[model samples]
Target: MSNNSNTALGILAGAAIGALAGILFAPDKGSNTRRKIAEQAAATQESLKENALDLKERVSETVAVQKENLGTRVENLVSDVSYKTEDVITTLEAKLKELKAKNKQLQKS
Candidate 1:
């Protein structure tokens, strides 16, 4: 995008220079040449404004997508941890019951 913008700027600069040179060399009236230059400058300004808006929108969309992806990743990680914790708790409960049963048998003996 940067490269494209640079190329666009270079093209606009060249066009402005070429137009100025042509007007200077022509036999047209001084007022007419100045008017033409102003028109050209206004047109260039509008073009730059449009390009800036487009670049801004693209950046905004990219950020939104990244944010959504990050949310999804965090949710998945939480779910995985929850499942692992449940499994660990279940195993510990089973071991505890077995140990209790063994202790009761020793008391009976």
Candidate 2:
């Protein structure tokens, strides 16, 4: 599990323990205690939903940034390879020309 998951679980456990302690120590009647517990649960649910949405957005943004970085790296690598290939071709052409000139001179002699 992720750190976020662990944090969320800890929050929920603490809330539950707090609610139980409140119900046990309060002087209120059982019906009122139940109502308060229900209210607390509803609030906690809403807060958890908001936190989950925030986490999702953060993960999405991180993925987008990483994807853009990978694309830039790939483009740079391709450009480097293209320049190297052109250099190799030019070098081979020069060597071929030198060989042809030597052959022509030998034939004339």
Candidate 3:
């Protein structure tokens, strides 16, 4: 299973065990004990739900930040490549023009 799933399961199991132990060891009467256990379970459920929502929000935010960073990096790389290509093209054109001029001079001689 995924790490997140395992972690959630562990949390649930621990909560269950703790709740059971508390109920088993309490000196209160049956009705009171049952009510307390119910309350604890409800509270645990709410807490778990809230924590899961928070985690989901954090993950979404992290993903968005990573995507933005990746886009910026890619744009920079493209700009650098374009600049180098233009420089190479300009150098090649200059060499070709010089060679053509020298060939013409040789033909006239």
TM-score of each: 0.76, 0.80, 0.78
Per-residue lDDT of model 3, residues 1-109, tens digit only: 2487669768887988898798879898999988988888888788788877877887889899999999999999999999999999999999999999999999999
Candidate 1 lDDT, tens digit per residue, 2-109?
A: 798788778877987897788778898989989988887888789878878887898889899999999999999999999999999999999999999999999999
User: What is the overall TM-score of model 3 with all chains considered together?
Assistant: 0.78
**Model 2: per-residue Cα lDDT at residue 53:** 85
Error of 3 at 75 (Å): 0.7
Candidate 1: Cα lDDT at 92: 100
TM-score, ranked from best to worst: 2, 3, 1
Supply every candidate's count of residue pairs whose N, Cα or C atoms clash at under 3 angstroms.
0, 0, 0
Give all candidate RMSDs, comma-separated.
2.5, 2.4, 3.1
Output the better candidate (2/3) by TM-score.
Answer: 2
lDDT of 3: 0.87
Q: After superposition, how far is residue 46 of candidate 1 from its true place, in Å?
A: 0.4
Minimum summed lDDT over a 10-residue window in model 1 is located at: 15-24
Q: Can you write out model 2's per-residue Cα lDDT over 3-104, one digit (the tens) per residue?
A: 977798688779877987887689999899888888888887887888788878888898999999999999999999999999999999999999999999
- Rate residue 6 of model 3 by lDDT: 67
Worst 10 residues of 2 by lDDT: 1-10
